[model samples]
Target: MSTSKGSSSRTGSQIPAIGGLDLLKAEINSKHTDCLKLIATNTEGNPSVVRSYISELDNSSFILTWESANPSLNGQIVFDFKKPLSTKAEILNHISGLADSAITDLKSDTKNSVRLEASKQRYCRYRLFNVPGSAVTWFMFAFAYYAKTSTNPISPVSAVLSVASREFFAELFKYAFYFRIFEGIVVFFICLYISSAFPKEISESDVIKWAFSSVLTGIFSSGAIIKLARNLVVSKAKSKKIL
Candidate 1:
């Protein structure tokens, strides 16, 4: 009787789940505008003049059109997904690759131009990508403040060492940090040395005050300094006919 009961039981077929391709397509479609903005940034083109549209999409491939005010910067890029994208990283990498390729093409076209202004603009655009944004600059200022204030209250050497340590830490963050840190270290030490040169005993407050003032000065003047540095480099390049 038990064997007969087991044989009488029925099994139902399982339904298949929905394909991921549709969801991936939806995600890409939703982010079309953001992707276009990223492309403009990467290409150093004006986002206000950049136009983009997703022309086609299917399970395996998609087509996109990006146009800019400059005709040389307009193009259609196709992305072929060898497999269904299961993660956001896959989608981002594809978009980033497209942007990088477009920028590379633009650079290649302008690399041999003899115009100085055009060459300088291209060079500066490239440098801008490598430079840290304003947020990081402010972070460095905060680091300097903490380093200076937390050191031995009576030791001028401690203040100097604190600044050097701060710059060294900055170097570990990225090469872009190098420029700001170098400028900061120079300002900090020059001010400290000048304060020490006064014919009086340097108090702890004096060291802290000098360091704080120098950091503030550096922060306020950094933009102009960077601009001047860029101009000087460009001028040198022009003189050598390298630009």
Candidate 2:
């Protein structure tokens, strides 16, 4: 494709704009990552209470406490920070949510089951529908001390990866249970609905087809419902905002 001089000039002009957008995105992501790392690590990148819960400092990964749950503890950040906005309150609110989660964990029974430091009596055994069984249940329980959560300063990705490695494999055998009864029940029901949608009476081929279809439907439907619920909560919170 050949570009006319006018087209080439316009294209050149747009490069700076593109570069600026990229830079802005990098800045925001870097900030979020810092927040997450701080929430996960102490000054030494070694949390004293690493075995107590899951802390998400990034989109894809999380720090599992001895009592952790959801893989993305950073979900609130994902939705709130996705688009452009300039409100100090919003950022503070997000951090407040993180702080709230830490305090709430102490009062609640959830995340304890996954704790590496859990007692034998409280060891929880459950399944996440589509996720690999080892990845979901076993890995979480076995690796409770691999990450930590707190209000410490954040660090670079290289530092985070280093901490994860050092803390990764101390498990010859350790486990426990952290029960979030209400949230756990909701999760169970969602899984049950998806599972029941695919009848076992069907042949292997049919069952596979039904399972895949059901999973897709379940994910989209449940996600939409959750999104609506979150928006409602956010709206109510914003309504109460003085600004």
Candidate 3:
């Protein structure tokens, strides 16, 4: 779903939609934001913006994001256009309106309010779900590290706090691994869930036991399975600097 636009692009460009488990086209109507994308990116003297396709939340929605060394050039614009805007002026104005709307709605304590709010919107689920999961994994790692030391007995809390910073970071290092393997793992889990839910002679508990036990064989590894797709890594804005 790379950016494709214009009168020509829109003609060839279709309303690609997902219904049930199949990719299909929706009813042909005037509401097409794909046209807006073509007009802006192909237009001359355009402000460089990264268009990210995030269709999980909304089919018509995509995130218009920008990054600059100049702190003031940042904006977060999520547009799900109900009707097509024809001209370059219309598209640009629409983007401006959306950015202002996002900023106005966003409530933040930081001076860098827009960026902070934008990130919070995009990654709130990650913080809510992933951070706690990472904490548990790191606790296990901390336990392993403490177990090898025969000199003294250490509390679980002490071990976790000692490795607290590395706790989050260690999980981050596996981003590349997770991105590549996400799809396969997801399909595997769906199959497992189905198997557990409906069984003939075998019980649901047996299915669970067999599935997890095979994880040692790397066939059913339970790891990061979120983030269905990712942009290319090399020279990409998100990967340019690793902290």
Candidate 4:
């Protein structure tokens, strides 16, 4: 659209003023990919059109507007670093909630479906620090080490995999148990394979040394030892629950 301007009477000439407004709201559509929220916005370009999660907007007029017009912005530098104001109650509530989570997270594991939320699900499995799973992992680890012979002996790997996987699936699908078990199994097996399998054949005494050094490895690998110690100390104070 082009506008042609003509001269008017010099003394009584009036110039025309033209203006338009564009308001847009960004929303998430796909539950899988649209992870970012429209916390805020600024005057920007129209190149950020990767995925459209445009949900409902408050303005009824814009709600029915053409979808093609609400283009996304790209390479936009939006800085609202000026800390937003918070009330005293809000501040106190935030602090109290953080404290509650810190204390309860050590003792509990709640089911959370918020994928976009950055969370510490491992804290949910804080209760099952060790014990049955650890024992199974240790046995499976040793077995996998021994079974890596000329023959394909995956007995230990298979057995422990099934147990850990089953427990992991059965327990609200929280794979912390599986993660710990699998990590334990893999660490020892990797150690065993590296020392004995590679670089010719190793001496029996050397094998024993590597196996023993794993004492520290096991303690640090899955925090089983540390959690166990904490459990004992905290349990003595009161009947603590780690589930």
Candidate 5:
């Protein structure tokens, strides 16, 4: 399969108003400490301090984000309403309170305390999981899963080929190639098992005959089928990219 690079252009907006908005909503419902330092880029004025959350008013339909770029602007007051404040002032007050509460909690917790250390560990592990680093790690994980399984241990090469075909072919053609390879492997093992199971009756001649037939009729047939399917895939991918 061919990979293509697409071009991207940057705009005037520093941080998008909705960047990482989904994560913010999730943090509100879950009891977790998520401290994110975002560097804002804008055309004018100081960068805004945005606090995102999914309160009651929006029904979580639209992402609710609060910003504190200018404290001296106006309406620097506290909030009293609790049923998911909708008005700008109410939401800003709620964010301020939330920030103050978070700060208070941080101060109460000792810097080198067990709770703080454990939290740091947990966050670091979670960060590692969330990072988009390498496909090798995921491939290794899949290999491990297959190795430990008792039945249907997936062949990594076959799995890779199957996925590549799937990306190119329709459902019917994809599955046909997948099953053909599967069948070829199964027939080989079955033949070996049968000959071994009947040690005295199954002779060298029978074993040779079975092996020869399996490759000629089974594995060879599968290879030809896959080759044709792969050619078709290449044609389609080329056409799509051209258009």
Candidate 6:
């Protein structure tokens, strides 16, 4: 009886065993190669471990050694064949299938983990402050109003006159100021949500500062846009009356 021993230097407690000496010899002989080697990973655990081999032919049995320190998470079968080179294709196919399945499963698990994290983030945002949805709705309504009024156009001269008029300013102040307050609140909540999403923890003072800055920006933006829109509407109406 002849025997061969293989050894690998890697970190871990577990290692894979060798088997199917008969089949491996036949394949190596048929291929007329000095030796054959194969490598794969075991994917059943939290961190998958690699399994690799260097093989040498003995008279009746082939020996396999593990290149890595840990054994596979799950035990795998060692292919054995009685007939020389008869099952070579089958054995290769089986190994290929195992490798493909392991890779596919790993990719699927990673994708699921990402999706789960995203869901958690969305839920937290909703629970903490549901401002994005409200902001989106408000913007949609404003867009619709603008779209409806845009059909009736006004000249540049009329637009300037409308902005200068006291009546226009009064209406602008009445609606724009209130809308600015709403916009400021929306901005404050948005800033809070964003700050919470960061990995680093923020202090109450920092949050207040963020809110103040964001609200100020929102007020300026909303006030200017609303003022322009109201002025355009007034200009269009005044021009129509004159015509």
Count backbone clashes in candidate 4: 4
Candidate 4 lDDT for residue 194: 45
In candidate 6, stretches whose alpha carbon ends up further than 4 angstroms from where it belongs are 1-111, 119-166, 186-210, 218-243
* Candidate 6: C-alpha RMSD after superposition: 19.8
lDDT of 2 by residue, 144-235 (tens): 32332223424543465466432232221121112222334455455455334422112233344444544443454344334434454565
How many Å off is the CA of 225 in candidate 1? 74
Where in model 5 is the C-alpha error above 4 Å? 1-196
Q: Whole-model lDDT for model 3 versus the true structure?
A: 0.34
Candidate 4 ranges with C-alpha deviation above 4 Å: 1-35, 40-73, 76-120, 123-243
Whole-model alpha-carbon lDDT for candidate 4 = 0.31
Error of 3 at 172 (Å): 24
Write one digit per residue (lDDT tens) for candidate 3, span 156-224.
545754665333433443443343245335544754564444221222344445444333322222243
Task: Tell me the tens digit of each residue's lDDT in model 5 across 1-243.
Answer: 111111212222222223223333353334322321111111112245443223322311222223454544211111223353222233334444444454454443312222232233211011112133224323433443333232453476457545654334333443554554565467556646744542222334444554454344435544544555566568668989999
The numbered model that scores best in lDDT is: 1
TM-score of 4: 0.18
Better of 1 and 6 by lDDT: 1
Query: Model 1 over residues 57-154: C-alpha lDDT tens digits?
Result: 44344555666667775665455565543333444455556555654654533221112212222110011122345666556544544543453544
Which 10-residue window of candidate 2 scores lowest in summed lDDT?
1-10
Off by over 4 Å in 1: 1-49, 67-77, 82-86, 104-243
What RMSD does model 5 have? 24.5
lDDT of each: 0.45, 0.33, 0.34, 0.31, 0.36, 0.41
> Which residue pairs collide in model 6, if any?
14-71, 21-62
TM-score of 2: 0.18
Q: How big is the positional error of residue 11 in model 1, measured in Å on the Cα after superposition?
A: 40
- Cα lDDT for residue 92, candidate 6: 42
